[model samples]
Target: MGGTLRVNSLAIQDRRGWQKPYELTGRLVGIIGPIDRGKSSMVDCIDFVLGRSVRFKGAVDDQLVAVKAGMQIGDEEVFLHRSRRRLGVVRVEDLAGDEIATVPINASGDQQELSDWLLARLGLDDAFASVRLPHDRRLSFASDLLPYLHVRQEDIDRFVIRPQTSADDAARLAVAKLLLELINPASERLGARIHDLNNEIRNKQRKADQVRDFLNASPETNSGTLDADLDRLRDDETQAAQRLKSLRDRARAATQFAEQRQQQVDRARQRLATAEDGVDWALRRHREKATALAQIDASLAELGEVAAASSEDRERLALLYDACPACETDLSSRAVPTGRCSLCTETLPGAAQHKEKQQLQRARERLVPEVAELEQNVTRARHAADLAREQLALARRAVDEDTADAVTPYVDAITAAATELEALRSEITTLERLKEPHRRLSERQEEINRLSEELDQAREQQVRVGAELNEPDDVLQRLNNLFGRVVSEFRLPWATGRARLDRDTLLPMVDDQDFDQRGGGSRTAVSVAYSLTLMMYALEDPTRFQLPQMLILDSPQKNLGRNDHDQDLATRIYRWIIDYFEVRREALGGRYETFQLVIVDNNIPTAVRSGFDTLIQFKDPHGFIRDLDHPHGEPAGYEQLALDDELDHDGL
Candidate 1:
């Protein structure tokens, strides 16, 4: 089966997994399926052919897997491409439609020449890296460049570039622009030379002025005096510089010492604070314990009094029991001494019974004193906790006093106006320590001219620092450099460089400008524009991206919402992509060769659909895909889940 060029068509061989091998046709293709229906998987399949793992949810577990795809560009048909394996074995048909050349997925080790070849052919060799997404973290690639995404969110602001971003991100953007600019040999070579020559001119002029001024001002200008004076002054400057450096080092050390000491005191104070709270809690517990002890003691005291009185009472009662155990006076006292009348004399059982009762009473009486002692102990614990709290407070106070001494000066300085002399002192100290001390320029006219002339020379000297910014290196060599710098700077993928290119050499960016109501959509459009622009430039070189010679993006509108202000952003994305494609299309030739695009979406501006060669709509899948020719015609063993229902947490 040959590939489909200029159009995307699907031919599925199996439906084993969501990623089951299926043929896709089109340059700009959109696989319209609900999220998780394997839209990204198609992209992964493309990756697999390039010797990359098929990614799933930002994870790559199937590195061993391969993707199978077929393509037809114009009259040429290509087939049997596998991921990573035998990738370059299948070549792209050349411009003539009859010629063939092998293509590499990526270049390695001194493979710069080969990469350049591919990039040059694809129009991408010298393009910036691009932004590719599965979902979430639109801010991720921005991190590589700005350190802050927007101008307003930084730790400090020069027109804040939003927070969580930095100048590093701006550098990435610079790399992107520089990449595309360098693709035009004239632009690249001339830009670099202009930079160098400009520096050179300035330096020569400065040197010329210096020699003229010296000749005019000096009397006799004794060669020896000039030489000696210059040498001595240099030495003096060097020594002063060294002293300044030493003082700075000492100051830093002092600051560090104070900080460490303060930190220690702060930590101690925190501990004391916690201890004080604990002391309060302990005191409360102690109070409760003391109250309980007091109650117990009172009960014990009552028991003691009861026991003391009970002893006397018991003796009397004992006699009463013996004299008349029933207190009945033996029903009438012993004088009436009839054995029957004498209290129906049951003798109150034997002495042994009385002994048992007496022992029980004695045990109860003894508990009072011991209980009182325990209560006293609880009272003592309450007092001890109170004392501990006071001591902890005192310790905290002492730490505060000590820390206050070290920090007070800085605190006062900070609280006062920023114009304190200390601020100037700090600047002076820093400069002195860094001492490249041609810093002091004398104020007289002679000095001003001299310093200004010297400034030109210093700038010229600085030119030896790095590679000329713009040079016509081999196309892919330049691309790699551009992509590497862009990627490293923004921490984004090299492929995403396509998003940052421009047709008119103008740069697009977001800064302190007022935005429309559609924040999400506008941001998304900007992101898409940047990504798409870079790709368009890449496609200009046949040596870069491969055939089918075009790329398509779906739902660049994914995160946009149509607020009053943001309504135009979505429309802008469509118009921009269309305009970009249109421009590149004419440059390539009226009949764009080996390009296919299939965009699928339910909710996007109508303008996007109308601009495409074909706009397609298909009924929703309804449920899991089923094989038309199969037993029972059901989902086989797999079950369709209620996607929106509450999920089971067991495995999770």
Candidate 2:
């Protein structure tokens, strides 16, 4: 089907500091600038225009580059302006200009008139609406976008390849698979072949019965070794599959145990950090109180001494003497200015002494009262200090940072649970993966015993005979080659990625195989490894995909695989992702219609960037109304955002 996407135009509406609108044209898409020039974040603006249910996962402190997407559909040049809302609004161009009609996704209507009319004319499905705008947000959120549209990554696989894996599998599906299987082999006269086989078997049985009657008197023939051989063959195939199954089950259990344990450890760490913070807060409060109390005591002591010195003497001294409180001297006399203890002297100028005596009495009154108050305040300060010290000690003593509790039990429980789940998943993965060998074993077992007995009887009867079994073509070699090509220079511990061809089954089984046979730990580890790898594998091939092509990876490179093959595989695994994209584009005419890869850039392959259609360096710079040319400097190149006042309205 022919497809087209573009942003027709934009208008500048600068409001917030750096935010302005730019008219974006989708057809003229290309990388904008050098790495540091903010070429990576340009897509965020497209996302903003798409209604932010698909906003960037986390927070960004600054404004981001913003642009509104104006999409023009095919032939009629159908115009639709979508600006980040539920279902975009549609418009029809008439002589009057673009006229707003119904919603794009049709919230109120049963079907969108705009979409319906467009698809009907184009001979496409209703799904075409999903691809209309192709906002950067949609590009980044392939995973989340599934529910909004019927377009699925694994549709071909589920419907055409492995229908049985899904609930949709049924007798009808089996019929379809059978038809496809026959078609793949270029089978002719399959209908006639079934009829012929049934008739021939009947005839053979009838002829053998007639011959036995005629030779009844010859001898009673009983082949003893034949039966035993047949039994042995049956038992062997079942046993191998069963052994593999058992080993895989144990492995799955181990994986679950590890996951649960890790979760427990995380919780415990959070709890420990919280408890420690609480203790620190209390400690700080105690220290603050204790220091304040000490300061209070020092202030009290100083005030107490001044008050106790001599309130009566200070008042008397002010009148005449003005002597120092400690010295208790007189400065009333002009000649010497003082006498030792002037107030206490027997011989004196009696009337003059009266004035100095009065001053001393006033000083004593003020000093005595203040000293008593100072003594009370000191007592209070001492008590507060003691209490603060006691509280501080209790807080220090209670903080048993090391002895409180261990995350061991929680981790162990989590580990055990995770281990169990892991084992189950491993067993499941292994059983599912081993389809080819299991099928072969079943067919071989059925024939082995019968043939052995035939050989034995022939040795006794002097005849050699054999049975025939249809040998299904071995696609293992082809599968491995496909995986290797996809993996290219990958690095990860990988047991195997396989594809088996079977008339009874649909789609090739991928992921950890023979896990049960592999030890418990190995099986469990392989299950996890294989599941992830299979997911990666599917994503690599867009045509066979069931999920989004975009990848949201965290720190997955840490301790990926331990064994020789696994470790070696881990080294090149990430690079394989790049290769997968490259191959997809090469195989098809192009790359994913819309795909995104968000990750913590570590150990990233040097060549991976080429696969990325756009690199969003997530440092969020500016947002806009999508008017590219206005007053501000041109950001990401769309002519400068021009002001409305700058437009030549007079020409109109």
Candidate 3:
């Protein structure tokens, strides 16, 4: 058995915003509240943070944005966070706030990333990663053990595990085997050895099946003729290969000559295309130059007319007045204008006019040289265009001549040889296809032999493990002895007379009836009794059980509320857990805390409530999400209507 899991606190927060963590503490924690006061939700929060497979129910409401929890598992602490909107995502963090890992919460079977990670971090042995059951079935710890740790309210009437499918039933059995192993090291070793042997046997069986399928898919073979047939096929393949090699050698020289001629033709074609492009580009440049020359000539003509008009205007202005154009006044004889023309604002200069005319004449002279250069450029461009066109034509002629002489004959010859080569390739393909069945027949026979040998070895090992498995049932007997005492004390009434734990189901059988068929009160009593027995057995000998040493029983009183006897039984169940811890602590002299038990329910007897180490009461406005106020009045449990059982089915 493992040491007790003393959960110091469970701190939950909304990941979307900064809310104070809803922290609950103590070894014997009791979530006490009225019906629907979020007691069940609190239990869910604890289970979720500790890696329970079922989704937290009552805690996840529409107002809840996200759910995150920080908890101490034994001595190590970890933080878990999940979004309400995205149920499948979860993030885990260390105490220092470093992200440890994030995983999809609902990963498929055999893809248990988050579960496996948590299992490793919880310090569980890797050997427990997978467990084998009878009929060659295997179960993952995530799907089996975690569910059993926290039994649901609806599942109280069911067995230790409420399996929803056949696969789940097998997983439950595997979990039973695992629990048994914890109490018996001999059983664990034998089980592990047997599992490994079974795995090897399965592998061998698979190979044998594959070999049989391969042989069945192909033509039947005679062992005596196989070698002879292979040799004949190999010889034919070799002869065909040799003929192919000879043909290739003979064609090599001509093929190389053809390739060289083709390369020459390709180069010629490229050069011709380049020259043609050059010719077009030069022609375009020549046309542009000619247009530029025409524009220059027109610009010069416009400049000459503008100059003549300007000279006439200067002469007329000089005759008009040496006057300012601002005001009309006669000042023809004045050196400087005193009166100005009323129509225009100007101070006319006689010497400056002649300087402007001289500047125009200089500009005209510059245009004449530019126009001549453009004409010369146009002529040069035309000549380049003509040379490029001639070069392109000459190149085309050379390519045509090469094609007519060297390339044509070789291309015809190569094409004929290629056709013949393709025919030989087809023939080779047919022969290989014909040889395939024989090849498969030989390989399958070899595989069958190998598998047969391995299967024999696996069977021998399995038998050895079986012998080891049969050594003794001392540990099981010890467990049952404890279980028997607990059930007898609980006093679950059966229709027949006697009640005992079924060795196969690991559940209580009353009067040869299954646990699920019993009355609600009896069922609840047996369930609690079963849990207490497991704790008592492990606490008696910590080395014998690998349970986490913590049990979370949610709303056990729901199904046991009908009569005083049943209620008394529920009270006893709670008192038993608290008393067991107290006695163990006293005996150990405060040296160790060996077990922790949590009971979550709407109703807790006053005595039971007072005796607990910790109590969290949800009343009035205070509930699961402490800060957020509920809008639809008081958050009430579904007391008015019958609630369906949440039978969570983990499937393949």
Q: Tell me the tens digit of each residue's lDDT in model 1 across 341-440.
A: 2244433322223433443344445544555655565566556556656665666566566556555555544434333334545554544433321222
Candidate 1 residue 556 C-alpha distance from true site, Å: 3.1
**Pairs in steric clash, model 3:** 1-542, 1-543, 1-544, 1-545, 324-340, 327-340, 327-341
Whole-model lDDT, candidate 3?
Answer: 0.59
Q: Estimate each model's TM-score.
A: 0.33, 0.27, 0.54
TM-score of 1: 0.33
Candidate 2 error regions (>4 Å):
1-67, 70-81, 84-102, 110-492, 499-509, 512-574, 577-604, 610-614, 619-652
Assess each prediction's global lDDT (C-alpha) against the native. 0.41, 0.37, 0.59
Candidate order (TM-score) = 3, 1, 2
Question: How does model 3 score by TM-score?
Answer: 0.54
- Tens-place lDDT per residue, model 2, 1-652, is 2222234443222234334333343211223222233322334333333333234321221223223334444334433334333335433443335565544543344654443544444333322222211122111121222222211122211232223333333332322222222121112123223334445545654555554444343322212332344455455555555655666565455445345445545555555555555555555555554544444344344444444655454322333345645775643331222222344443333234445444444544555555555555555555555555555454444433322343333555456555655665565454444334334444554455455554444443321111111122322233344544443233223435342322344233334333233443333233223323433433344332233233333223333345655444533554455565456556753333333333322234344445444333323232222223322354464688666763657552
Regions of candidate 3 where Cα sits further than 4 Å from its true position? 1-6, 14-22, 50-60, 85-89, 96-112, 132-142, 182-450, 460-472, 494-497, 589-594, 627-652
RMSD after CA superposition, every candidate: 30.9, 38.0, 18.9
Question: In candidate 1, which residue ranges exceed 4 Å CA deviation?
Answer: 1-29, 47-54, 58-64, 71-114, 123-183, 190-518, 526-551, 560-652
